[model samples]
Target: MADSKERLASSLLELKKYQEQNNTGVVRGSSTLGRTHLQRLVENGWLEPVMKGWYIPSSPEDVGTTSVWYANYWNFIVEYCNSRYGDDWSLTAEESLTIHSGNMVVPTQIVIRSTKATNNVVELKYGHSLLEISTSPASEVAFDPIYGIRLYGIAEALMFSSPNYFKSDPVNARANLASLENSAQIIRLASVNGNSSRVGRIIGALKNIGRDNIADEVLKFMQRLGYDIRVEDPFDNIVKVSASQSPYVSRIRLLWEKMRGQILSMNLNLSRIDLKDKDSVLRSMETNYVKDAYHSLSIEGYRVTESLIERVRSGAWNPDAEDTDRRNALAARGYYQAFMRLQKSMATCLEGDKFDLESELNEWHYELFDPCVQAGIISPADLIGYRTMQVYIKGSKHTPLPVNAVNSSIGALCEMIEEEKDGFIKAVLGHFFFVYIHPYMDGNGRTARFLMNMLLCSSGYSWIVVPVERRNEYMQSL
Candidate 1:
């Protein structure tokens, strides 16, 4: 019995060593990682099953267990898709552009067009699924070597994408369309495939986005091919999308533009205050802390009461002091710490100073989770950086961007916040984009609300405490 236990521990150590040596989170089930060992590792929380035969490494102390999912979404998909279809599969046009634009949010259903596909759905954990469409791609469909997967060529994708793509992801959609140096490739496809409808849709998208020359050229070339083409604007309206050559920048621009309208329509009854009214605002924050902590913690599903928060704030919190649930108590403590830091951050933002706001938010995220680290609920590394895996919001269809998108999105977000003239937009959108990105493994919502209030303070609005009861409405509004 003793020898068996020792051998299992040895296997665990070897697994960790192998992961470090390979510098990869992916662990495939094999002879060494047998069913018994895999089940044992999962039971101990050191490995999480990404799919039936795959797993990603985990920290035993990490309470928020979705780290592996966010960190390895693409890797798992690429691998799983290959195993299922060999080389006969291609990702859909929209998803390819989503990746191209650095918006790697785990889509609820990844659309894979493949010749050998079963046309079935592969259900994954956390409401994510793989949707296989059995369609034979044209012979001209080319794949990029860098993306490590097969997809339709830029021109083919643009020609085949749904019209709804223009409104939902106009920046990426337009950027991709504008990126094709010439319509020669698409025209060749039209000539070869004799697909007039696809050519017409492409022309409409191009013309709608102000690419009249390309649209006209495509029209002429397709006509020269002796095909009568009918074209209509794919999108409802012709939106002048602003974008530079950088696809990442364009993605950020599109996301901001899309959400800004909703922010304007939000509860605008909150009166604006003077930024110089520091003392008055500080006093109000002092009064609002207890109420804010309770709701904030409650919204996060922490069973914390105002009384418990008051106790924690008053230096009466002792995780080891009683039969109290230490986890909840520590969470309250962390929230108080984060709340205080936010007050200081608000002061700085209002004082007309320029500091690296990114690091400042990093500090806030670290503060929010510091107690969890100390309580041995999560490792110290979880607070040190952004999430590594895909995350899905409960009951929400929107999937956040991949880890690759986090830094660029935040950079663009910070730039927008500083340049915007409307404080309302800055405050509301700042909060919206932060959580939309979901950069951290946990505490994203709480941290976002704090940052929102900081932006609001800059514009002279009081802290808005969303009661726990309205969590559903709040999420739905978002």
Candidate 2:
């Protein structure tokens, strides 16, 4: 037993050194220490197989979850392609446009162009695959400076993407179109290989998004180049473009604009409560406290029970007790605290008191994690603002925006919620986009639920409690 432990320790030390030296998670078989170290790491779950000879860094906690694979998807693609093709490959034009529009959701299948002869599909973990198109000319190729993945330039992506792509994903298409400062790149690309129909769609898309000046410039330039292009609008609807130039902000605004219509169309039978009758809602909330707390915490993977929720809510929870140090107990207490705080905010909203939307939501977040901070489970600094590090959703392909994008994106989201007139639209889109941005490191779901219920209660709709049994269905809907 002692000898086996010692050997495993040495192997771990060697693996640590290798990871530190390489400065990346992607590892190839030939680059690993010997068969013994590699075998040991795999058995202990320190490394996970990506394919036959390749591996990625992981932990035992990631055994059944796709988080590690999804988090490192782009990084592994970069390393694998660079090693196999030596700068001879780039992402497809449609894929490049998707990323260029700041839609970082992990794609189902990534198509690549390579100078190599064979066209093949390489299967990856968790149903993700790569479609390799053979012997294609890799023009307009550029590397993403941050992730090092090869892709097409924004202008080329716009010009080469299919006409139907503009209609299918208008948010991504519109955001990319709005990113252009001038028609210079489009005109340059169009002059050489001008397809009249394709160029016409580009002009129509630009004009659809309130970019008439650029549209006029492109039209005139194409006509001067002797292209008989006729204008055509590909989009089914014209959306008011957001004023902000930041792609992240633009993307969030577009998502809200697209979803708000659907939300309005829903047949939600909201029961109208009188504005002055805040007491009845408070009484009902107190009655459902245990059920609400139990389901909300349990859905978040907390080992919470109705009795534990009751103990916390009844003020029998002892902060200094050793039993209370358990994470589940700490979580129950925190949920209770945050629940109480939300009630107070809901009261103000029901009474029609003017409040700053951002400040109210921040207070809810602070209360949600304050118990964990007191227990030293997390730093108090974490509660000060938006998450400072990147966070991933378990078993999800949707990668939240980066740390730099969170602050401004969240600000834009709050402004939309405040300006929205319909309560259902506010509640539905508020919850959907909040989780989409994932502003906080932890408790994003819980915070989003609180936001949803707050809007619902203030607007005379009943408070909603998502049961733990429906956790899977609820998450999938998100």
Candidate 3:
């Protein structure tokens, strides 16, 4: 019995070694030993039965299974592909992007290209499917050293990917692209000849990068090769080239010109305010808050007063109270609450030595909610009710800018401000971009005024608040 137990333990160790070497659990050993040995291991909780004749080594941590088990599903596919096709497996363009970006936002249907004719969709655990489409693999498609899988060329990747995915938002797309470490790889792929049409589309698709020259070069090359082209520049209206054109190249050329201008006009600069002395800056921020809030509220036609703030904080106004005065009082209270929320959020964010404006804004939302609820400005029921109303009424509309998005957007704006040599453009665009993002749900106008004052203060310019009389012009400029 001791020798038999030793033999079983040896077999389990061998199975674990095999799985680790292959990065997969499926292993075919001697048939007689395999079935019985696997069953014993399963009974002993030393292995998990994934499928008939397929088992994975299990530990105490594997007791509560989750969707993360599906991650190993890719390893299974890789092993199966290698066994069947022998080192000829590759992911499709979209799948490659999903893997490259480490984005687990899995799509229901994953498109793949292969020399073999396969129409069958292999269903994965948790309703994911890998749809293998038949196509000739590009010559440039090669194994990524880091990921250990075949990847599509950048040009082919951009071209084959759905345009809607890239067009979700220019700012986010640009940020993602900029975050990529190997942008030159894409540029190299774009330089290829057969992919000119796709290259043109990608150039037009890129919202944030200054790639007009590259697009022009691509256009000229394609035109010389007798390919009809038209560009669709979606970034701005100033480029004079209309999307309406007969040939594709004509539209593409116009778009390229316009995109070039927009990209060039974009500011990319570091913030002027020194983040090192955060304490002193925060003290100054509190001082500026009083002045800015007063002016901002005055411009918004609110008779803002210290007494009004105190009343709001002390629960004199009930957001849900049926009385008309209660409603008015709540509105007044909301104004002060919003300002204080912004101030508190800013203070928390600036409290630490490091700058994390986004985190500060996110924290502010949770922190502000309790105070407003406690003060009777908003009931607990109103929170859910308002959120539901917002979803139905503004479902198709854009989300009102939250503080985190605003702060991140501001970080981008500050990048632009520092890069542009001209001070006038910096000042105007700085204010324009901040308000354009509309960070807060109700206090955007006030916040925009506050941001503008911050910029003005930094630049030695007088902090100018738009008067209530000039609200129309102020909004129009924004």
Question: Which of the numbered candidates is closest to the native, going by highest lDDT?
Answer: 2
For model 3, state the Cα shift of residue 128 in Å: 2.8
Q: Each model's TM-score?
A: 0.69, 0.91, 0.45
lDDT of 2: 0.83
Q: For candidate 3, what is the lDDT?
A: 0.50
Q: For residues 1-478, could you state the per-residue lDDT of candidate 1 as single tens digits? A: 5586686696697787777885555677755467677777777777877677787766577534555576566667776777678877878877777666655555777888888988888888787888888887534556543236576777777776777886777767876765566668678877877878878888888887677877899899888878899997777767654434456656666667777876676756767776677888877888999998999888988888888898989989887744456878998999999988887877776677776678888988888878778878789887787888766675454567656667777787888888888887888888988888888878999989888877777688778899999998998877
Worst 10 residues of 2 by lDDT: 239-248
Model 2 lDDT, residue 292, Cα:
84
lDDT of 1: 0.76
Q: After superposition on all CA atoms, how large is the RMSD of candidate 2?
A: 2.5
lDDT score, candidate 2, position 146 = 47
TM-score quality measure for candidate 2: 0.91
Clashing pairs in model 1, backbone N/Cα/C closer than 3 A: 69-390, 70-388, 70-389, 70-390, 71-388, 71-389, 273-460
Q: Per-residue lDDT of 1-478 in model 2, one digit per residue for the tens?
A: 5597798888788888887898777889845778888898889888889999998888988875788898888889888888888878998878887776667778878888898726889999889898888866348786664477788887788888888888888888888788787889799888887788888998898889898988999999988878889999889888757445566788888888778877667766767776577799887777777888888988998887788788887878766667634678788888888889888987777777897777887888898888888878788887998888888888788888878788888898899998999987899899998999898889999999989988887887777899999999999999
Q: What RMSD, rounded to one decimal, does every model reach?
A: 5.9, 2.5, 16.8
TM-score of the candidate numbered 1? 0.69
Ranking by lDDT: 2, 1, 3
Residue 396 error, candidate 1, Å: 5.2
